[model samples]
Target: MKRLTLIAAAVAAAAAMHAPLAPAADKPVSIGKLERVATFDGAMPTGVTVTETGRIFVNFPRWGDDVPYTVAELRDGKAVPYPDAAVNVADPADPAKGFISVQSVVADGRGRVWILDTAAPEFKAPRRGGAKLVAVDLASNRIVKTVVFPAEVVLPSTYVNDMRFDFRAGAEGVAYVTDSSLSGPGAIIVLDLATGKAVRRLNGHPATMPEPGFAAAIDGKPLPATFKVASDGIALSPDGDTLYFCALSSRRLYSVPTRLLRDPNVTEAELARAVRDLGVKGASDGLESDAAGAVYAGDYEHNAIRKLARGSTTWRTIARGENLSWPDTLSVGPDGYLYVIANQLHRQAGFNDGRDLRRKPYELLRVKVNAQPAPTN
Candidate 1:
């Protein structure tokens, strides 16, 4: 499993792979506490999600490294792969059927773990075999069902990066994903959980891509934004009123009503109109929304987290540069702590001078939310 190599490539220029935006702050976000988590030392951990039992699962996106336990179940403060990995009992060396690169790991309303694998070898060209969304029973830690994306919807250039689940969609569940394609315009792909059908709408909404001229300072040096779809962080407001998102390259955050984003019949033109710019919230790598209606953003600029209060008009820098290292992602742990993946991405060879300057155990820090974490799905 080449999770490290894949991330070094997938997340590179990701801040702008969707859309490049203007720069805002040069200071690092202060979020406090920098400690290494065991799981991240070997793989370039890109995504993390916690279950109801306080068990944590982190995934590596097919980065170029041998990942013995790329997708693990963290217990007793230690990380272990969920179930004993056996070669596809169906076929051994094919590797295609095995647990490949999971770009995102999400815990849904039912407390189920959904691992999204871009499946493509190195995520180089989006292929069908590598495009699957797996539902795992956390209690048993085994894959139950694997939903494959339709080939037409799975563009060869697509990098299905991050995802959000809407269980109420059509009485079953729906998954909204961002295809931050590195080689072309980005798009938002929607999947129907029941029918196994998927749709690609707003294929190139300006709001879904990066803002032009968007530049960010990583490692004290200027790095151009690589605006693509995946870098555009998407999160649901606690009240579920809106879906907050922004391009990693841009300093601002924008959102459209969740009602519109999930409307299967909503026209692209309407989606274009539904987009509401939330203005700049500094620089960030990922976005997550809780049930309290506040949208939490991991400010990569200041190494802290920022929030947009429910119904508020301005962005607030609630947490900043507090021992955070290039905060890579933002999500709520089942224990109600805001979990962060500080991958120190920019320090890697992609942005730096051919080096893996990230600290060992790459930190996974969490802070208690204002209240109990809300379940978006």
Candidate 2:
């Protein structure tokens, strides 16, 4: 009878100890406030950029969705066709003339917005005249220049993912592009704004390629083995000295000197040696920098946004929420906020056994960061 009483008392003590701590441990401690700026009920949006005047622009890649226009400007709570509706229409014969599956849009801070068109809808082989970079004048709202990539630079498997501009580089400026190809190796393409000349750098480098056998766990479930993505996120430092990038399937971050990348005399071997692994920053899809020198990234695995502050190697979470599902892109707005897009990419049919588990109304959210966009000019 005494032994039975002791067992009951021990059980009661164990239950009392477990009950209070479990609930508190499981609850997430949210940091910064996540403010919803817009909600997408139709197509899933990937990239977002904000101009100095606070004009919000977003892009919708041709990934099986019924995207009316590839790029739109969010004005008065509507995704209005940017610049005009005519340029948004794609012409198969003259793919370079129109926006064919634009992947990213960036405001140059020099009174222009650059649009990167992949020209490879549904991740298919790019059309000859399709892959191009276009610049539009914000004041005139007209396309000022269109620089099409050479057939050699844009390979059949190349998917031009994201880009950043450095107006301080050369005569007119320079743009860095990421080729996040899934079927082939990944690379960075450096484009001279003056001559429209482009060259591939660090092609097939392990830093740019997807981590072998890497699988991201989303919602406590591991991504399928078939899922793989290469160097998808790219950003530039405030002074345009270092270029930071990371692969989609990897947690590691890397950077190289901008001068070495811009040097035409630098060989691929020399450039590869210059690459620096900056340690793991969680699984990120989009990366951005601010004038304060902080590098921001979307922590999709944790449903949060993290930042590597200037001079700090340790990453710190700035914001977190349940609605931050698959935070696909990050943009530092001029209004001192870090904007992000939560598109729920893992719930798509491609990742979920051909059954789309995505619910409607993906989100565009922002958190106060008290920083300005990195200056390019």
Stretches > 4 Å off in candidate 2: 1-29
Worst 10 residues of 2 by lDDT: 17-26
lDDT score at residue 136, model 1, on the 0-100 scale: 84
- Per-residue lDDT, model 1, residue 260, is 79
lDDT of 1 by residue, 29-85 (tens): 233333345445677777888766666778766666566655766667666665555
lDDT per residue for candidate 2 within 163-220, as digits (tens), equals: 9999898899999999999888898999998888898888889999998767777767
For candidate 1, the 10 contiguous residues with the lowest summed lDDT are 13-22
Positional deviation of residue 187's Cα in model 2 after best superposition, in angstroms: 0.6
Provide C-alpha RMSD values for all models, in order. Answer: 9.0, 6.7
